[model samples]
Target: MPYDFNQQIIQEFRANRGKVGGPFEGARLLLLTTTGARSGVRRTVPLGYLNDEGGRMLVIASAGGAPHHPAWYHNLRADPRVTVETGVFTVEAEAAVLEGEERERLFARAVEADSGWADYQARSGRVLPVVALTPRSVSFPDLPEGASPPLHADRLDATLVPATSDDRAAVMAAIRSLLAGAPALGADVTPALAHTGGVPGVWVSAAGGSATGDGVTLYVHGGGFEHTQPALEPLMACRLSEATRRPAFKVEQRLAPVHPYPAALDDVVAVYRSLLEQGVPSDRVIVCGESSGGTLVLSALLALKEAGDPLPGAAVAISPLTDLTLSSRSLDVDDGRDVISRRVAEHVTAQYLAGAPADQAPQSPLHGDLSGLPPLLLVAGTAEVLLDDTRRFAAAASAAGAEVTLDLYEGMPHAFHASVMAQDPPAVAMTFLRRLADWVAGSRARGRRGC
Candidate 1:
């Protein structure tokens, strides 16, 4: 592990797309560049890596079993920001060193993958450091060239029927009409009377047959905090059911402006609890939502954890509003490209908070303890104002040692996944849903395998 020899390997790695000959041939290697803690200079080191269950790249500070910690580890501690190069792609990532039980578990997995790590740990005597390279931004390589402009720009001239506090009935009617107008992508919708702990909801499943399993998806629909329409639930539920090959329970939780703060949170938690009470194992359940509903999905997980309830296998949030404080930088930067403006976001937040602290945990989950939550998949569009909400939440969750995957679609608007059937080229949206479904299914399978 001499400096001159390391530099030779680094040169070989760069020349060979992260591959090198001799002892490191066919090894999984990545180039980590960190700013020096003292000198503030960029330092690059080639290291081996292991992909964790959360899809994060794990790099060990073995330093070839040196007595002292690696210099790059010190740099990362001083500044978490780091650049990662794997093969031909380079990504900006935040480096987080795992600790205690989480560190032990990941280290064991690494040792299992490669026994050399155990020898490194034995020789070092020090706890071998494990660093998670959590991506800050993901690039979409498959995006079509010469694609259409942003979706919101084309619809800007369309009629704007504002949903107001005074016109609650009008808002409900408008939401129903919008849902009714959406093209049904071939899903069997059935009404469920007094489902989910006496809360009414809809059951969306595939058309061919009834979905049979303890595994179910509890879906909460998004309409800021004011609007809750049964019509909107099935559109996404059917797709979810089709994707996961399980029944989707679309919960009609109480909305804001009337049943503020804990009411909606309580109702969603009740539905989740009811599923557990009805013989559905916690690991077989997956909670999912969008927009404000996405907020609820995260909040419910926090509440469930607080109550000592068994957590679900996984959860999905699409364009979720994680911060009611409206403090994300993207809110101002991406405002014009999104459908929800600052004025609308502020009004919705006020209605939802209703005198409650805006930064309260389980209300605005961004401020909550994200440690014990289930594996999460967050999907958002680059142009959406709430894009930062998703990104920040994902980062926090990952930092807290929770499994999280964030997918950002280029040039799409807020909740654009809902526009799967409406867009001219629905390829991106379709791909997103398919990936979500695959994640859910895979998570369930992993649970069955005791991972």
Candidate 2:
């Protein structure tokens, strides 16, 4: 309705080479400069785009479901030629509207990739238009002279090499050392050993003034399931404790390529059961983790449900790896943007699964029955390779009648919340941590009131 907001976004987009702050910071946005149909003056608008099969870039003219078509859409209809800036690269493209089944199919794919499009459509009683922007020519400057760049250059980093078993101990030690002197953020750090349901683990907590009697958080760390980092998990545990004003436990589980498949899962389940047996009411405990640790938290919930065991009050999965199959579009779209890689996924899958089917329940919880699980809060960054995993899982879980809340951070990377202190202004990670704490505390309060 107003050009002022669009103008501000346009300015940020141009200044940042496609990157913009605020809600759209980490989102996939492209600046479309079009020739006005009547005015004939050039007009620019920032829109989200999806990469289609035939190397075509797809943009939805949902206009947040406005009654009339967006001005840019009308401009494109009159003049097919358009200028597109995808943050990373600028290109000349021809836009063509899709109709009938093609439009429906692509729209469905967009909804699957991001449910926000569906929400926009639902809010307005109109058929959203989909336009295909086929590039006239692709350019790549960083590639070797003879090497042709792929259809899309979304990845900003090179492919990573997977770590082997020999690197496990050293990696763990280094992470532990880095987190050894981590600031508690006003909480006191305490180290303790615990045995949950006969499974032993190292328990670290942030207590004292910040501690509350409401409940506790079980913090799981992520290292591709191959190794356990003592420092990182403890640091996260401390943050959780401080944020929630409750004690937090960092459970140490066996690593894969050594214990494999059900080993880590079993250990976490034991810890959960032990918490229940130790007089912690089921509704007072919150289970949470990042990366593979997130996967473990979800899998444990499934395992506990199947076994008729009590469930926790709520769960939080941060940039979790839900699909062992490694089949998410963001994996390709975020290849260079994320630190994790296909090699690491394959390596971790091999080590953890140890010949188990990729879609096996409890191993790949996305394939498991999500019913009966407790309320889930999933946090993921649009820039993460596992973005699709969290999105798909949240969608599936919600469809199964589970209480699921998915928070898509615009531009965060994997485990962005793991750091005790974030360098960015607004400290998005710390904000998320505090949000998690509030959610957990609220859940407990509701339960106590029998709400």
Candidate 3:
């Protein structure tokens, strides 16, 4: 195709949101943008694509059988980072050149799907290269087309206190079983080591995320306040960055039995203050964390409010441990049904608290005043032992005059959103991310930058 011809099609496609008229009208296609391997200049070209069931876009580099691989192919071979405009939205993707059995199988399938691929291969006298573009972010709609947020989410009616018949050994057994199946969700992230407010951590970006952006999503990982998943934390942070559409700083806070009580909490607050000092608007920033990380998020809010510091626009806690007291009833009622029993909770709380009073405000965020805080999105599963931790926190935050949105997934275990880390994740996990995206947008719309 002539340079002028490709330019016209690009203009038409952009104007029509992925559609082109004349010979290409209504064809399934996407705009592929690749960096010139040598010159480092970006080039965009429209290509016919096939939807692979593994969540990848398949493009054949036949180049009309011209006996040489396409320029884009060589460009991607040098640098796999590519930008794809699917007309739904633009996202960053990593280009993987298919090879061996996977290549033969997909190429065969492409031929079966369209004889044009076979015709091109025959004319080229060389095997066509098949490339798969796996999006670095998990994109989802705000709820399914027919779905809607419930008007009210009533608390689960199960008993809070434990029964004498509950066996400790049985509870431990159940905890181990449930914890074993916890989804290891995460993304392919690029991380750079940095210190925010003198607190050491990594700035992470989802594979295709932009680090040069102004706003940031501050992410704190969950590890029961004592342990850390060094290898997996970056992956999780990457996903959060993608979900919120911002570069993320994954805090490496001090752990328990060593840097107990207020150490970790202080780290979160310090990093937040660093963002504000660096000129990132409070409203443009998002503080999101999971498990104990979520606990720190809420605690940080209370601390910030007490000190008259600015708060982020919004927050999301994915199954946080709000009460170090371990007094939530679901710890007993949902005991064996979920992972991590009362014993584990007690050990974690004792270690992190290290003689700090559990009834105090920041230590036990569930005990503090939650008034004048930013909009919050709390997610949990009904099958988790911390169900009540989520339930009680939502109830208290709402009662304390804070904005709250509790998204519950029934029959899901603790930290269920971790499942979204997989290449092809379950619907529930995608829904969690979609809901977060919508909630974040809504928070920005209302300008809920906290005081």
Candidate 4:
């Protein structure tokens, strides 16, 4: 469902009626009044504020740090003349790009305002364009729905891959056996089978193993495209395994910077194919991941469809880095959240996606076709800088006619699932995993009705 945050937020330190809540509470915010590119009217958007060096408000054109620029941002670039409104007062300003030491000093200031911005920058691997809304004067243009975001082909053909009787039996046996064992502490996670043909390097989580039940979920972990392991993700993995009451098999895939790009994607494809060969039905699987892992999940889904493999029933992502372009305006705006910085994330992106084309289907799922993938659940903290990536990706997916569910936890940090050790983590994480388990179980039941 579309978030009604603009109307639902209880607190008020206002900007525009459309201004969604972010992490920086006291930081000064401004409404950029710009003219529409195609239309001849004025449009106002509330954005996060940063005072570079001598208190000059700095706004980076990091449109959720996506590779492409946002429409409003592009409008300003076309006509540098614009107006700025801080609840205090309105002033005319010129939107000029910032670079070099001036850019660095100001970016540092912006990061100080919100750390999550740093994380966005890191994930994007881009210089994160910075702009200054300096005082100026000009007539604003009328803003209309300037243009729509990019669209990739949909991968919902997996609905064609029916669950066979034998596939149902394997899944049921895995789930029952997995449910029979003691759950792994902080590591046991809900597992589901997605495809029937077993892909190489993949194993079906059977019942009565370390974690029990019929196979209910398929889990992939995130490491920023360079450094994560299934062992490291045991906390959420285990939780998800037990919650789904199935064997949750973690893909210990290769990383980037060395292995890079499709190496990880290849492993995912290989594993899914292996499952199908083993008689696991695609409809019974739920593909999932977090951060970089989230990126892999979506990318793998697209690859599967491209290879004519059946798609999974549902998927979940925690702070998934959907946009590799790092061009969203929010990267600089939502900077207060922790656990990552835009600088670090961007660096990882540059290394992992290095040499790979920006529009490559396997490198960035955001650039792939999102239509007909599957039911999707996207969870991210309101404070997270990548929140815009989640926002845009979900919007894009919805626009593409996919069922997308998004939950933005207020004040939660990036990768909140891994931060279960952090003070006051959400009870919803645990609850969500449990719900996922039930959903997988229910889906399995539906497929086995005649069996």
Candidate 5:
């Protein structure tokens, strides 16, 4: 935890001068000065700002990709009254935590200001806190004086569907077909045949690419609980290989409904452990998955931690049905925009759990103790009903001191990343994957140099 002298300049500019030249340009910023929750002393930190149709300043409680909320965030939660300072002037305002539709709307605007926030949301398995700072009476310099602008509720974009069944044959078929297509190998894509022992058809596609360089994404696919073709997730896997230049592996784990719950999770754990045993270092692997595969990623991480295995570098969960209870508000609110409905999620959960409680940790990652897990990346469509699931998961992860990133695309449906081959949004997804791979590659290089 030693400080980097080079990073010190950037941090100093961010904290004191309020005009850091990297990553946050062209956007207005403010210094939120708050008394420390425990220290009882004043602490001031500059934050990226978001304003709705009204000029009210909105700031997310993202502590620069840290594992926990900054001390100032705790102070504000304890006392909502805080002071705001910008490049020119200061003002007094009240902090209001926005949730649900209001929270989502405000969050979208914040993403517009810093698209990288989508990565932060993906890293934290929790909804990044969105707090609006409204001046007591609008006499602030950041906003023109005497402007008591009319305020409107941030509208939830009307593009979510919440009621599709998980058993839709067309959706499942599409997933299978995508998996069946041969990967378009890149120059850096290194490959080796998957050896699954007597399991017959387990394939391992590994790509070693990450923005941080210290992370790798190990993926598992989902087809109900019993049937998933690991080869299907090649679109993402190959992209990782091209991006990180490391290795990205898609472990063909057993599926559910038939293989059910622990069967697939156990297989994933074995694959992760095998990688470490094979000399691939623990800090270099990140587990990733889509749908039930995302669930397997979470479950495997938990089990690994419990079994005293060294945790992987990080993880990514896309449209992960982390909660089997199907109790999130989005199941109803997003019913129209969702490709898979709550009924389907519930049915799949029941079949997977057989007779276990819906809120079991393996069944609902949101309810699990998320402390000590590696950083995570979460991607979901603003229109899909699982939006709430991602939001809630990110917030909880943040509260538990884990770094998380979330990307909520404007109006895509569920598993939209799967359709990247034939869709517009896939370009955005590729951009995200490339960034992720670069980060992981950097992390790996840093780790080797003992950084």
Candidate 6:
């Protein structure tokens, strides 16, 4: 009903797609992010806008009848590239300053719509500026034939297992035994903090590694977005930390059917932002996750990008559920072939979205603009129900001008990379680790953008 601060209103607007309560309720409002002319930093402000010709939107530099134009007006004039988050779509647009009769006609139209523009113009003494934001065409990249993972020789054989296990807990236990079966924690990583972070997680480091130096690994665990394995995730993090040479924070994000949609994603973002706030460099941080956690890693990147935050050095998504709508055709084609079925996917998505639109983002990372993200490594198995989900995302991200490495393990089922968790991990698992470590090392060697 009432708002105290701009950030408070902004939080509500972002959470509700630019909607706010009280006087601004039902008003034509949008959040605008522009590069500051003087500071060379991005500044986001909430503003009202009007529709224009050819689908362009007009935003006026009224400054609420102030003596000077708003800082955003100066910022946009210096850098015409602006990001507008309208309820309908969040997009990048080129801001064109209207002049002469065009500005007159638009100002007249705006005054007719609200009468406030005229008041602001009369009160300010100078003519107000009307900038038209025209969205540019985005060319998404298509993956080449070689970009797809090579099919495993035993791929069809891996599909013969039960489509879906009835004893879900038992299935989980079996997986835990296979993945985190103790297997003697290495002497290099003998010490591990039982818990850590702004979010619930475990702090694990190798003997040779720095706890708060160089880089940090933010590891998010997967559980179909409903289940959380507090006991097992640390071991997973240990595996990652050992492989990456970075102390890993294994995030225990909130689960669904209770705290759904943004709760888990919000936890992830908070943890990452907290790390940055603590003086950790963004280019040195690596965000990695598995299954739904992988989904969050990508989603958090999108959210952070939208908020004008710096991205990480690189990211890894192992068997990610990129599309929450579960529209991937592989879900049906690999129904009985993969370990999980279409029904399981539906339940996970329904509980996680909890009435949020599945087709939209940052709930569905694949649905969001993928540009400006850090280098990404997407690992999946050909036998997975989410094969296409991961593949399609890689293609899209690549097209969106992000560096992406799509690693496919032939014939391996969902989360085949977890084989690295096994005692005396299989060759495939070791191969995955070798590539992972190499990729991460390579990311560090390159510039923040992987140049």
Top-TM-score candidate index: 1
Listed in order, each prediction's TM-score against the native is 0.62, 0.61, 0.58, 0.55, 0.57, 0.60
lDDT of 1 by residue, 1-451 (tens): 7889889989997665455899888576788999999999999988888765444789999988888899999999999999876642356679999999999998999888789899988998998999998765432111121022222221111011111222333323333445557655466666332357877788776633332344777888899978965544576787777776677888888888888998999999998888878777677777889999999999998998989999887888989999888987668867786778777889999998999998888899989988877778888765678977876776667656667666665445677766543423245556667777667666656653101
Model 1 segments more than 4 A misplaced: 1-180, 190-194, 207-214, 421-425, 445-451
User: Candidate 5, after superposition: displacement of residue 336 in Å?
Assistant: 2.0
Worst 10 residues of 2 by lDDT: 155-164
C-alpha displacement of 120 in model 2, angstroms? Answer: 26
Taking the tens digit of each residue's C-alpha lDDT, what string does model 2 give over 155-252? 11111112223233333343344555544344455533244677655454555432124566787778988887564456667677767666777778
Ranking by TM-score: 1, 2, 6, 3, 5, 4
Least accurate 10 contiguous residues by lDDT in model 1: 154-163
Model 6 per-residue lDDT tens digits across residues 289-407: 99999999999999999999988878889989988888886788678867788899999999999899999989999899987788888887756799878877876776666776666
RMSD of each: 15.8, 14.8, 18.8, 18.1, 16.5, 21.6
lDDT (tens digit, per residue) of candidate 3 on 1-451: 6779889998987664455799987576788999999999999988988877535889999998889998999999999999887543354689999999999999999899789999999999999999999865321111121022122222111111111122323333443443455334344444432347999887776635443344788899988898987766766676777778778888999998889998999999999998787677787678888888999999998999999997787888888999887877668766776666777788889999999899888879888887777878888765678877886777666555566776656456677676555544556666677777766776667656621
Score residue 427 of candidate 6 by CA lDDT: 60
Comparison by TM-score, 2 against 4, better one: 2
Cα lDDT, all candidates = 0.73, 0.71, 0.73, 0.59, 0.61, 0.73
RMSD of 4: 18.1
Model 3 CA deviation exceeding 4 Å by range: 1-195, 207-214
What lDDT, from 0 to 1, does candidate 5 have? 0.61
- Give the clashing pairs for model 3: 160-329, 186-421
